[model samples]
Target: MSKELRSNFHEQLTEIRDGIAQMGAGVTELVPRATQILLDGDLEAAEYVILGDNEYDAKAVELEERCFSVIALQAPVASDLRSLVSAIKIIADIERSADLCVNICKAARRIYGHDLDPSLRGVIQKMGNQARVLFKESTEAYLNLDGPRAAALHDMDSYLDDLQRQFIQVIFESHAAGTIDLQVAVQLAVVARFYERIGDHAVNVGDRVRYIVDGWVPEHPYAESDNDPPEIVDGVIVPAGQS
Candidate 1:
């Protein structure tokens, strides 16, 4: 490649990376806003998060187009090939993250104007915090090209899964004890599920980072443990609660 052509390619790649980062940041904001809306019973905030989905979708489409253009025009090889491929995969993950945020907003709408038990709120908040941390760390790993950091982010997804299980157990126990109304318990379940899905998307981003650096895709969607089943302490599973 000529020096000038190489410079232009680098510029385009930088733009693509920046676009992905913008999408990541946008979805990160959405997660917290959606969680807060649910916690505060704020219908307007929840609606805003829902409406913001279009922006994320648009950016993702643009990023994908840019990646395609780079791959076709530059004919990148080796690490460059991996980077472009990773960009394509990252855009898909970002789109799904946005969709998960939309789901959270939808859950918030269902529970709008309803009072939630403080314990349930606490559980949701904890899940939200964990999801946010995973998102931030995954993006940082991408920006820094730190595959090990990305791998660590995948490990954190298990924490989100554990928290989701605890949330569901609390809801079930509360309903069984007659402390929480069945209807409210079900809504809280949906909220926890949304948060759990957000965590899954974050792990997906981490996997993409691994692909970017090592050109290797994870066999499973979520973090996998070294131990085998039957003796496995926590199995690797996407969306959690399923084999």
Candidate 2:
């Protein structure tokens, strides 16, 4: 590549990277607070999150377009190509996670007048906090290309999954005890599920980051996200002179 071409590529790449960082930071502020919007019935805060979702969606679309432009104009290969691929995938995940935050906000509106069962409220709050942590760590892994840490996000996701399960049990218990009416229980359940889905999206970001660094995804989502060196499997990693 010419010096001019290389320079332009690097500059565009930096811009996209910075944009991804900014977007991640924006979403982080909302995930944990979304539950508060629900519990507190803060219509104002819920509206704020909904507006932020629009911004995230717009940014994601713009970043994805930039990625495609780079691919078409620069024909990036190797790590250069991987960078674009990672950005594309990460943006999608981030955008979806933000949408889930909006879902939580909408759920908050539906339950505005109905006080959540105390038991269910605790679990939802915990889930929201855990979701925030996952998104933050996932963004760090993506920006730093920390494959081992990114791979480990799955372990973190398991905790959120457990919280969701606990939410279910609590909801059932609350209803059985006549502490929470069926309508409120249903709304809180949707809110909990939204938080759980946000965690899943963060894990997806981690998966993409690991793939960007390592150049492959395990056939299964559950595969370890370690920095272990690759090994031969059948003909997959043939030796230097042995095809």
Candidate 3:
């Protein structure tokens, strides 16, 4: 490549990286804001989170366009091809993660105007906090291209799965004992499921980071059990088995 063309390519690559980082920051903020809305039972805050989803969508679209431009104009190959591919994939994951936050906020609004048992609220809030931390760490790993840090996020997600399982058991126990209203138990179950999914998406970002840097997809770090684990026969885990 000519020096001028190389320089342009590097600049475009930098812009893509910066754009991803900006989107990551925006998505990261949504997690806490959505959780706060849930904790405070604030309808307005929930609405704000729902509206903000569009912002993330727009950013993802912009990043996708940029990646397409780089591929078409620069004709990247090998590692550059991997980086562009990873950027495209990561944007989708990031956008979905943002959407999950919006969904959580919507759920919070649905549960608003009703008095939730404090114990259930406590559990949901704790799960939200844990998810937010994972989101932040996973994005940081992506921005830094730190495979080791990205690898570590899988363990954090495992903690989230354990929390979700414990919360599910609590809900079932409460329902069986007639301690929690069935409707409330169901709502809490949905909330727990959302939190678990958020953790999964964060792990996806980590996997994409590995793909970009190492040109290989990593196994899902959050698989529940060794027995009957999600099939990762090759580098890529089968989507069907991904929780």
Candidate 1 segments exceeding 4 Å error: 221-243
Clashing pairs in 3: none
Give the poorly placed runs of model 2, Cα more than 4 Å off: 221-243
* TM-score, one value per model: 0.87, 0.87, 0.86
* lDDT value, candidate 1, whole model: 0.76
Which residue ranges in model 3 land beyond 4 Å of their true spot?
176-180, 219-243
Best by TM-score: 2
> Candidate order by lDDT, highest to lowest?
2, 3, 1
- How close to the true structure is residue 166 of candidate 3, measured as C-alpha lDDT? 82
Kindly list the per-residue Cα lDDT of model 2 for residues 1-243, writing each as its tens digit: 999989989999999988997888878888878878877999998888877666788889999999999999889999889889888878887887777777777767766687666677788888988999999999888878899989898899999999999998898898898887777676666666677778877898888887788886757753322111222223253321121
Instruction: Give residue 29's error in model 1 in angstroms.
Output: 2.0
Whole-model lDDT per candidate: 0.76, 0.79, 0.77
Highest lDDT: which candidate?
2
Predicted candidate 3 versus true structure: per-residue lDDT over 71-131, tens digit per residue: 9988999888988988887788778778777767766765666665566667777888899
Question: In model 1, where is the ten-residue run with the lowest total lDDT?
Answer: 225-234
